[model samples]
Target: MSIPVNTTAQIWVPARRAADVTARGARLLRMADGCAVFAVGSGTHHFLTRGRPRG
Candidate 1:
């Protein structure tokens, strides 16, 4: 499965701040046309739908 580019979707990404203790968590990210991706450690992950589609 693949996430379409330019689509707004929820994804889990590496915490951007040192204060964030969870290491990784869910976030709403706008999928980019060319650079949209999800990764952890040294591996890449795919994005899956949580519920219904968003507009």
Candidate 2:
């Protein structure tokens, strides 16, 4: 699936800093190699809701 442009509000931080960011409540989305992605702010909700398939 592709992330919506408008709702994409995330930050890429080094794996070491992932814990620090998460400690502040950012949701961890992905981690690969030594990089990490954390979703922040209200855009996360918008992104999730917009991508859901309606019945």
Please report the candidate that would top TM-score against the real structure.
2
State the C-alpha lDDT per candidate: 0.34, 0.49
Per-residue lDDT of model 2, residues 1-55, tens digit only: 2345556566665554344333244678886555567676542232121222222
TM-score of each: 0.20, 0.42
TM-score of 2: 0.42
Candidate 1 on 1-55: residue-level lDDT in tens?
2345544443443333223322233343434432223333332334433333223
Clashing pairs in 1: none
Question: Looking at model 2, how many pairs of residues clash?
Answer: 0
lDDT, model 2, position 14: 56
Pairs with steric clashes in candidate 2: none
